[model samples]
Target: MQRIFITGTAGFIGFHLARLLLDEGFTVAGFDGMTDYYDVRLKQRRHQMLLQSPGFRATEAILEDRDALDGAIDAFAPDVIIHLAAQAGVRYSLENPRAYIDANVVGSFNVMEAARRQGVAHLMMASTSSVYGAETAMPYVETQKADTQMTIYAATKKATESMGHAYAHLYDLPTTMFRFFTVYGPWGRPDMALYKFVDAILDGRPIDIYNHGEMYRDFTYVGDLVRGIRLLMDAVPVRPADPADIAPGDSLSPVAPHRVVNIGNSTSVRLLDFVEAIEEVLGVKAQRNLMAMQPGDVPATWADASLLQSLTGYRPQTDLRDGVQRFVDWYRAYKDSGGLR
Candidate 1:
């Protein structure tokens, strides 16, 4: 069995990805900061569940701790390193911009250096759809120019993409950066929309509808998002001998063994419609709090997932209502189990 070392295994997407990989019989080593950014108990619970699998082992440490990160990766000697740990939260970036720099920028650099030294076959990192800031283009494609970054969070993620490209070019590292669209599902982060909306509604509180409920998002289910990551792990990018040889619409770097793929549902659901779906799932109406768009917030995000489908032969097709139902079920169970406390 192949060994995979994953960062942020206690995180939302990372936890789901680790569980999936563990189920597939891969020997997995996980590293996490277990930050108090949200409820530490939720993260701890995720780690506790993963530990049920004998093939899974984990180290609790922050990504910014280079020595700890390097030690864990070296001890595991994984064939692949998936870097998913980063200071994640767009609006929170406004309150704590320096945290984004510390984790997303400096921490990402450490992961790249470790991957280079280990000569891992693949080094995959997570970027975000937020990086497509100020670009009004519908169905954002990977090949398009992504220069405008509205917040420090997006800027840091964009910085990591550029950094990954440079490392791939200079050291011949096989690197892939996946841009995730508003990922939501079971075991989702409390900071994300679905979780907050569900939590507030269940507690009889008003749910904030930003942009006056006119916003849109390509709400990619967490399961589909992680499946894309797993498939891309095998579709390793190769530096093309000629730039002309690259396929049309492909985002493969012509000068390096690197690629950036957008993993999303390819459908932009209106914010109001998403809330309605949640209400339907819970059989309760939400106290809607209409408000102006927050700073650094985009009105919409839609992904062009053709490149992901071409590489993986799969696309995220989960229906909004069905996904919402799944999350509602998990949220109810978790809340009943005193997870919300």
Candidate 2:
């Protein structure tokens, strides 16, 4: 059986990815900090579910805790390593910039070190479309100027892409960094837009609408997001034979086995339409407290996912309404399970 070592297994994306791996008969070794950035109970619940699968084994440690992570990887001896843990959130980074450095910057460096030491077949990690920064580009392609990052979180993620590339060059580690665009669905992070909107709408509270409801996002469902990741696990890059063949904005290190791919729905939906999806599911109109754009926030993010299809023959296909309804169903069940007191 192929073995996979994944970080952030307790987080939303990690939990989903780990479950998918387990079902596919891959023996998964999971590591997670289980930070109380959101609800510890939710993270715990996700972990609880994964434990029921016999092939899944978990070790807990902070990614920045290099020594602990090293020990865990040594024990797991995985064929592949997926680094998904990071201090996530653009606004949160502004509130606590040091957290980004500790978790994202130092943390990712630790993951790269582990992957290099293990000499894994491939190392994959999650990046955000926020790295696109303030580019007025309509659809973000793999080969585009991403040097301009607006938020500390985006900057750190962009930094990791560079760091991963460097590691790939130095150690010949095959690496793929996926830039995800607004991933959403059931079991999503509570701090994300969909969850917060669902909770507020259900509780009859006002939901914050950024950019005065003028924002646009390539809202990809979590299942499609995970499938794209699974396909990418096998799309490892070979170091380029010639630097001149590297396309523009490809984020390919001429000397390394590294490339960046955009995994998104490839369709940008208006913010009001997303809110309407939630309202439609809940049968209630949100008390929209429309406001100005927040600092370090972008007005729109769209992905050019043709590269993902070309590489993996996959594209994220979940529609907003269907995805939102699934989330609502999960939310109701989660509440019924005594999530809310």
Candidate 3:
């Protein structure tokens, strides 16, 4: 079995990815900060479950601590290094910009440096659709300019893409950055839309409908998101000879063995319709407290995932209703157990 070093194994996406890898017979060395960014018990539960598999080993440490992080990477000597740990929330970033800088920016540097030293075959990191802020084009493509980031969280994630490029250029380390588009599903984060909506609807509380219920998102499920990452791990980019030869809409750098691909459902789901799906699953109606869009939030986001399909031969196929139902099932079980809300 191949050894994989995954940062943030305790996080939402990381938890799902680590479980998938372990089930596939890969030995995973999980590094997590176990930060209070969310419920630490939930993170602990994720780790606890993973520990049941003999192939999984976990290390608890913050990504910003370069020395400890480097030690863990060297100790594990993984075949691939996946950096998914970060201060993950668009709204939270507005309240605490420093967290993004510390976690997303500085923390990413430590992961890349370790990957460079270990000479890992593949290095994959998380980018976000928020990086595509303010782009009016339908179906945000991989080749679009992502400089106009609306939130500090997005700006930092976009920075990691650049950071990975420079390292790949310098060391020829194969790197792929995946931009997520509103990922939602089982084992999802509490701060995400699906979780919040589910909680409010089930509790008979009013759900906050941002953008006054006019927003649209390309809601990709967590299972689909992790599968895309797994496929991309094997689809590492090779440095091209001429920058001009780079394919149109390709986020590949001219002189680096690095590329950025959007991982999302190609279809966009409106916020109100998304709420309806949750209600259907819970068999309850939500009291909508419609509100204007928040600062640094865009009205909509959609992804053109053809590049992902061409490279991975797969696309996120889970329908919105099905995904929402799966999430509700998980949520209800957790609520019943008093383990999740």
Ten residues in a row with the worst lDDT in model 3? 332-341
Sorted on TM-score, best first, the list reads 1, 3, 2
List pairs with backbone clashes in candidate 2.
Answer: 143-249, 143-250, 144-249
lDDT of 3 by residue, 162-192 (tens): 8998999999999999999999998888988
Cα lDDT for residue 218, candidate 1:
97
Ranking, lDDT, top scorer first? 1, 2, 3
Residue-by-residue lDDT tens digits, candidate 1, 1-341:
29999999999999999999999889999999999999899999999999999999999999899999999999999999999999999999999999999999999999999999999999999999999999998899999989999999999999999999999999999999999999999999999999999999989999999999999999999999999999999999999999999999999999999999999999999999999999988889999999999999999999999999999999999998899889988988998989842
Question: Highest lDDT, which number?
Answer: 1
Model with the higher lDDT, candidate 1 or 2: 1
TM-score of 1: 0.99
Tell me how many residue pairs clash in candidate 1: 0
Query: What pairs collide in candidate 3?
Result: 143-249
Tell me, by TM-score, which candidate is best: 1
Q: All candidates' lDDT scores?
A: 0.95, 0.91, 0.90
